[model samples]
Target: MIRLPIKFLGLLLFFLLNVGSVSAQYKQTVLNKTQLLLNKENTIPLGRLDALKIAVVTPDAQKYGVFVQQLGRYADISSFGFSKYDEQTKYFNTIIVAGTEGDLSQEMLYMLRQSLINRKNIILCRFQEVGKNIPQWAPLLGGRITELAYPDFSDLAQQNMAMSIFGGLAITEGKAINRTEQIRLQYTRGEGSGLNIAKMTQKIDFIANEAVREKAAPGMVIMAVKNGQVIFEKAYGSHTYEQTVSTKITDIFDLASVSKIMGTTPVIMQLQEKGIIDLDSTMGHYLWQAKESNKANITLRSVLLHEAGFTPYIPFYRYLKPGDVQSKASTSHQTKMADNAYLVNHYYRDVMWPEMLKSAVKPIGNYVYSDISMYVMKEVAEHETATPMDEYVQQILYRPIGMKTAGYNPRTHFDKDRIIPTEHDTSFRKVLLEGYVHDQGAAMAGGVAGHAGLFSTANDLAIYGQLLLNRGEYGGMRYFKSETVDMFTSKQSKTSRRGLGFDRADPDPKKEYPSRLSNSTVFGHTGYTGTCIWIDPKHQLTFIFLSNRVHPQVSVKLYDLNVRSRVLDAIYETINEVK
Candidate 1:
């Protein structure tokens, strides 16, 4: 599937308060997919093919070299070969045949035609350093087949053009695939959005200004999408009171507990889809270590709902004796905790896990917001998938959704400045927590945990909100099934305001995590580090907020100011005013 940020806070001050690219003149008649058939097209015979096939009609794969490289950024290319005499090559969903009529024998041409007849998407690309109109196989391919001037654009732009041409229909070959577009969402800016932009803007400005003025936090990013179109987005304040740097819209922030939904829960949902983990099954069904402990009888559904009565948190760092500290990672202590701190190897396994299993409370069937729930669930997922949670979710969710900056341990993949500072770390690892995780437990676990340790920009989180809002599909790709999304995002427990793994709007409207304006249909999670991801299905909206409210020093100013929920209420009011 192929398709197609900054902020100024001084701009609005009204009712409610809170908060959180382009290339080219080239155009293609693009759809979500070719055969899922967005616009009218004749029937296509569906195949089990998933990956792209670069069918080089010329003897050398050299002709399609640059184009194939561009395609690689969009989708994984499984095989490349000459299409001559190979009827089996048609099994692939998308095929790019690079040859003019001159290079094709009658047999190769026949194979290409058979592929088209078999409903395979074939791209007739004329390899060129500069753009030219060589209508090579346009007639045969039945789509606009202009060879783009490679020099006029970037590799990313070239990939966008290819994606626009190939479309989203082919990726249906795989369950849970990426609809790789360089741009993830479409923005409308309140035009025809039913919301009152002027009033909304004024309130938004008030929220930002108040947050900064009240000293709750120096900076924040707020973004809202309504009816599938981004209606409002803004960034405000500086990275800290020092004001040495202004926070850009592209900056990624520490997403504390939001990691539960952003990573762990998604893995559990996907694993459930594969029949790897059963929600109703006991914890012992998956993790052998839990078998001999009190956790063995706990149900995964209870764990997700926070009704398993797990401990709210365990201060694993405090338990660390002086001997547990290491100047650096080693054979015995291989986990890096922070910029200059490392932890003993198998600390979580040998220490944390045993403590969790032996804890007095097992499954009390009562809601208790517990970090241990996510920790255990993360292990359960790793145990089932045989892959680390980070790697597994990256393969299945973030990468596929066209999310640019999402995953654990931002330091490994991004520049330090690109990741906003979470805190000055007055205690524990007494250093500025920039590019390192803010949660001590997750940092102790080496920056990959079920509950916290994720870091991402607002846009990446928005894509996830859109993923759930569209009922497990986005940009024409499906991740979880509609039912899976419903079960995970809808109310699942009578004892708590929780879906399977998501935090729902509080049943008692006054105490909603987001706002009293929110209904039960809203489902998402909040990060302790002043970040949130809220998606509403009934209203067709997704709201995201990211802030390092703990920067310099931990303070409750953001909550005391009601910055997030007020902005959310402003959105609802704006929409309601128009309606």
Candidate 2:
């Protein structure tokens, strides 16, 4: 027996006392409600079944470790150790037994055999069965979760088994099987969606494949919903040029500039809805830090409208002095940039913000697309809400919508492989950027910027898009009023095709921006990393295209070849087809 240190045991015992009672109650509640739903015959799925209703058993030493202590942040799960199995075996339809080869007790092995005989969902990983009492079929339940660790273990066998048993289990080829939920859009398929289903999907697939062949991107995930039904949702190709790991529908992509609309704008609108700050008021009234500079006088409306007279972009990375970039954080350099890179502390407040504040404002407002404005707006969000933009959005918006994998600083929540590679930065932080923000300015701000640095899978992001399509309401929860969504998504700028922190189709007759078929009523924003989301209230459509066109290096092939617009046109043509 590997005797755990006494210090570890003390913490473990403390956890069992404080954390065990609640876990036991939670487990029993799940046990009672779940017995009837485990079968594959129920018609009602979300009768408020707790997704967090999970039972976890770790080696005693690891109970207080990162694996268990940190797993619940990303998922709504309730998990505990092995002591309850004998008392609850009759109640459990599934269980995960995780340990090394020598750690499985004969008693645990015996229970495993019994559960296998009971036809339960059994997952055995990183361990080998011992003793003659175990069944031969038990070995077949074995597998490995090598890619997951620490905080990301919420996707462990528990989520997969939960997904399978709780309304998602399937009987295929006479054998019970569990699968990660794909095709997550709830209302989908049928004659009522009004489309030539087969032809529309075939054309969309061809467009995506051609985009890959031309290297517009290595891979892509495309999803489109019309009239509240998912018309198409599919993932194509691999994560990179090497094609080693084929992209899954659940993979998250860096939302680059799209973060302005998806991450920052919603919060601003909600603040307005609560009457915390008037949209029409000058930001100078609220930002005391910028009182002496030109930025203080710009209106919040102009900032969101991208007409705040700021420059298009500033290359802050090019001006880095010695000691500015450090391999590890120190008292003076406390901001982390990437896996090994950290930025000097207060660089934003003392250096970047001062430069932005002093930068000459163009003659009032002629409509310049600037990241500088959103950079200040992030400060405004933090200043007004007294909360970090990342945490504020997560607690107020994402967690409520079940957007499990949507947020800034994705590496903190997911494995690198789970996030698609954005680019290889030859300019600054010279590592291949995976699970890191691709935008240099945002990265310097510790990967949480108003203009960039948000990531999410197509499914989770689509929920946000669907919220706008439904006029600020989704899944029986209302995040914003109908008037609030209307004000933000509608055209709010006079000289440009910009909504409140959103992008719209150009009204000019000479330009074919976004799609030739798109009307002026649709609103969305495109990311620099080959991703976009377009929501159309007129047609009740929400389209999302996520890719990594900058994987090896920066390229505009996604636009040069008109991949997004062409693919979008096909859907419109198919939907309007006469049968």
- lDDT per residue for candidate 1 within 43-101, as digits (tens), equals 12211123334443333456445545544433445445663435546556656555433
For each candidate in turn, the TM-score is: 0.73, 0.72
- Write down the RMSD of candidate 2 (Cα, Å): 15.8
Q: Residue 434 of model 2: what lDDT?
A: 86
> Candidate 2, 520: how far from true, in Å?
2.3
C-alpha lDDT values of all predictions: 0.70, 0.69
Candidate 1 displacement at residue 382 in angstroms: 0.8
Q: Please, what are the lDDT tens digits per residue for candidate 2 over residues 317-377? A: 9999998998787898778777678889878778887888778888666788899878978
Off by over 4 Å in 1: 1-184
| Candidate 2 pairs with clashing backbones | 52-76, 52-77, 164-169
For model 1 the local lDDT of residue 428 reads 82
* Poorest lDDT segment (10 consecutive residues) of candidate 2: 23-32
Task: Give the runs in model 2 whose Cα sits over 4 Å from its true position.
Answer: 1-184, 187-194, 329-331
